[model samples]
Target: MILRAFLFLIVVWTLPAMGPWQDCEGAKACDLDGRSYHIRVPDDWDGDTALPVLLHFHGWGRQGDLIVKHQRISGHTRRRGVLLIAPNGRGRTWDFWDQGSADVPFAAAVIEDVAKRFPIDRDQIFVSGYSYGAAMAWRFACENGDGVTGLLAVSGTLRQTERCPQAPKHIRHVHGFADTVMDFPMGAGGDVTHPVALWRKALGCAAGRRLPEWQVVSFLSFERWHWDNCEGGHTVTLDLHSGGHFIPHGWIGWQLDQLMGRVPLYP
Candidate 1:
């Protein structure tokens, strides 16, 4: 008994201490290795149910904390019963321009860590971002989209790249016709529709057909297009607004509804 106790003590001393796991309450920040992310659960969540998750990335010069506090984002996630996760970029920005970026591994780590602590529906995982962060989302979807359900990108597109190994199951891209930061149509970065074109080519998607105008607000409307007939039952959509570089009101909510199948993809 004495020898057994000594051996047990030695084994215990050799084992590393468990790391902190943040709970999904009030958008608390969770740490994984040296990086950080924030998560929030719906108020009505029963704590045991496997809920859908939206992994949103913040734009350049922003952190995950700001995304959790944004009412437009957090409020919608709460109402939809979807868990929200916002990962902080390395040095306040993502390395999306590089093909071999560390951000990809960091993003994977964030998702894995969140799943370890929360009852997340892996099949319902969605990735989204804004501006530069949107570019990062595009990169992720291109490189690591095997298990992701969909991608909702706003006010940004992918950088110049020659290869995309995998295509996301679904893609919805929203941009402004008058956007100057990322520019409309094409800019210094590249064509805003570059990723869509790539997906179309990869999936052998039919030529895009214009959808009806979707009036979101009294003064704002979107001219939409959709490529429904594609290989592997994939989908691609693009929404162009008259506003500048910004996420329009009701935009995220409407996309979430479509993703959740509460609303049809087209009008």
Candidate 2:
């Protein structure tokens, strides 16, 4: 009886600690070390397959719950069989200007926690955000690029220029020509293109040449620049639209398709 009791204690001690978001469905709140976030799995997920994930950040004054419920973002992720993780910034805003900010570590912690609860495809983990959240995503990519596949930034970029320890495997940034909130070409920082240029330089892409494409749907049009030649055979794309500050319709889906190697259906 004593031996059996000792075995049980060993088993209990060896078991992994329960995560705050374990067994959660739809959009549910998750807390880690006083920080909060939210998560959603695809409705058709088999629970055994290792699925890719998208860590999407919300705009200023917005929370993770909003991102989880966003039909465009969440719907595209669900249809692509990708898990969605949205982390709430402290006070509904990200402190991403500094490379040593707390949000960077908090973001990493959230990813680690989620991986503990589910089978995640570490190689396919993507990061994205809108407006201020996009700025956060940029910073996260700069600091944690080694751990992620790529970044999809919309309507925003890094708040300031800082040396990136690692660059993401790929990057796709979409912005508007007429954006006034964050400004076009120049965002919170002097040059919105700084991150892309930095990545291009870091990855050693060929100098002064990029392929351009145009895609139009109904009344919306986009001008895209593609850099296919870079170190490690990675790609960097920048999509400029004619509209004001906002994510283009079906943009995320199209980008995801391209990343997943599926035929991109323009939307």
TM-score, every prediction: 0.85, 0.85
Model 2 TM-score relative to the real fold: 0.85
Candidate 2 Cα errors over 4 Å, as ranges:
1-23, 186-195, 208-212
> For residues 129-220, could you state the per-residue lDDT of candidate 1 as single tens digits?
99998889988888888788898988877754447888778989898878999876553476445546767787789878889998756688
lDDT, residue 121, model 2: 95
Worst lDDT window (10 residues) for model 2?
A: 14-23
RMSD of each: 8.3, 6.9
Global lDDT of each model?
0.81, 0.81
lDDT of 2: 0.81
